[model samples]
Target: MAHETSETTAASSVDAAASSGRRFLRNKVPEVTVSFWIIKVLCTTVGKTAADLLGEKAGHGLTGVSVLMSVLLAVVLVVQFRTTAYRAGVYWSAVALISVVGTLISDSLTDGMGVPLETSATVFAIMLAAVYVVWYRRERTLSIHSIDTTGRESFYWLAVLLTISLSSATGDLVSERMDFGYWLSAVLFALLIAAIALAHFALDLDAVWSFWIAYVLTRPLGASFGDYLSQPTDDGGLGLGTVVTSVLFLGVVLGLVVYPAVTRKDVTQLHQAARQAA
Candidate 1:
């Protein structure tokens, strides 16, 4: 009887450790809500303005800017992926850098190589759709709620990269080719995002679908907003310049990251609730 009890206790300890590890892996993605949207928009906006400032204002040119940002993004992503747990600062910094690189990719093709925005948009959309289809087929779930595994994180980043590229192409197409102007494009995207939000909250759309639709739209919305703030006064902007716009958004994002990191209040509460439900 004594021997049997000792074995049972040992087994229980092992099981507990395994369960804890599993839970840690599963909660990688941040919860989708107002704060998440706000930070995401700020990151994308910073991405657009910062990339322009580096490339045009700094005279690094498109290739130099693209290469520099791409290297930085890769380094950030390495740190982010290697992190055993989510660090808000690392994660958001990676996101901001990725946003800049994605925009650079599209811009290089469109402005440097003279590829049409319409063509780039179509190709990026197709690529993003393919990523989603494959991710779903393999994982059997597209829930951001369950991004704990390496495979899910891979899919998540791939989707994000493609969405950024597509959004850039589409935004440029509307603003430049269609001559809608920055302010008008921003208004149009804002309305579209509002419609998506309404559909999600009021009309009972699936959470995954609603989240993704909103995510894709936010990219263009951020791009348009950045353009509206940073473009020349003659171009209907506030004449703030890209440097000022980038700095403003970066400051906001830094504050958001720091708050979450220091408090850990949000993280603790979320995990506690998840434990209770489980």
Candidate 2:
């Protein structure tokens, strides 16, 4: 009876370990929530203004700023990947840095390399589509909720970078090439996001597609909004300046991130439980 009991306990321990391993895999990313969207938009706004502040205002120029931000982004992502579970600070830091890097990439193509914004947007869209195809083929899903392994997380970040680049290029194309202006461009992207939400809630749009589409739109919306606040009034903005605008949005982001970090509100319940168990 004692030997049988020991065998059963060992078997149970193995099963528990396996369960914990699976849970750990899935906890690397946060759950989607309203706070997620709010922070994402705010981060994009800060991305736009901060990049401008460094590249244009602070005299680093686009090339120097891009190199600096890209290096910083890579470091943050390394920390992000090393973590075992969802951490608001690390994850959002990666997002914010990627946003700046993505914007700089689009800007470099347009202003530095003399590529048209329309062409950049089209090329980025193709790249994004290719990433999606490869990701889905390899992982069998494009849903963020399934970012359970390093491979998935790698794909997720790549898709995110592409989306930000595509959105920046598309926003510039619409606002500059089409002459929509900052305010109108912001409104246009905002409405498109609202439409996506409506379709998801009312018309049964696939949640994954809706989330990805809205995610792409949010960057441009935030960028336009940031430009409207940061540019001079003569240029149709409020004259807040990029420094002020970036600081303001980043402050709000800090405040919002603190709440989730303290409460772990953004971490899924299963993730929290698994983390505690581990």
Candidate 3:
């Protein structure tokens, strides 16, 4: 009897160790909450202004900036993928970089290929929808809770890229071509996002769908704000310059990310702990 009990104890210990290892492999994406949305918008604003700063103000030109941002994004994403756990810096840096790359792609389609902004926007929207459909079919859930696997993360980032690209094209098309102006465009998108939030919280809308809808809208919301601040006064902006706007938004992003890092307020496990205690 004693010999049999010892063997069972050993088997149980191994199982416990395996379970602990799996816990570390939980989904990496942060929770869908107000902080997440705020930082996302800030990152997108930086995406727009920083792209302009690199390509035009810094005189690297579109190709140079595109290559530079793409390389940086590749490096950041590699680091993010290697970790079994989420690191705030690596994750958010990847996002900011992917944002830059998305902006470059939209600009290339419009300026380099002479594709109309409205057409590019429509094309990107279709691509984003396709990603969502395939991702849902494969995963059976579009919830961020399902992002633990590498495959889900890939789909998530692809969708993010498409949203960023489409938002840029659509924002510029409305603000410049449609003459809505930067301020009005920002307000419009912001209101739409607000409605999504209201519907989700008050009207019992699906959490996942509401989160994604707001997520996509933030790209244009931020882009419009970036354009409003960075463009020349004659171009319907405040004439703050790309450099200033980029620096300002990037600083805010850095600060917000650092807070989450230090407090672990946005980290899934820690967030749950904090909530439980409250």
The candidate that wins on lDDT is 2
lDDT of 1: 0.80
Candidate with top TM-score is 2
Which residue ranges in model 2 land beyond 4 Å of their true spot?
1-23, 269-278
lDDT of all predictions, in order shown? 0.80, 0.85, 0.81
Instruction: Choose 1 or 2, whichever is better by lDDT.
Output: 2
Quote each prediction's TM-score: 0.87, 0.90, 0.87
Model 3 residue pairs with clashes: none
Tens-place lDDT digits, model 2, residues 99-120 = 9999999999999999988799
Tens-digit lDDT track for model 1 on 106-154? 9999989999998999999999999999999999877765566788888
Model 2 lDDT vs. the true structure? 0.85
lDDT of 3 at 210: 79
Residue lDDT tens for model 3, 77-145: 888888776688888998899899999999988987899998999999999999999999998877764
Q: What is the lDDT of residue 191 in candidate 3?
A: 95
Of 1 and 2, the candidate ahead on TM-score is 2
Question: Residue 140 deviation, candidate 2, in Å?
Answer: 0.6
Model 3 spans with C-alpha error above 4 angstroms:
1-24, 58-60, 269-278
Which clashing pairs does model 1 show?
A: 25-148
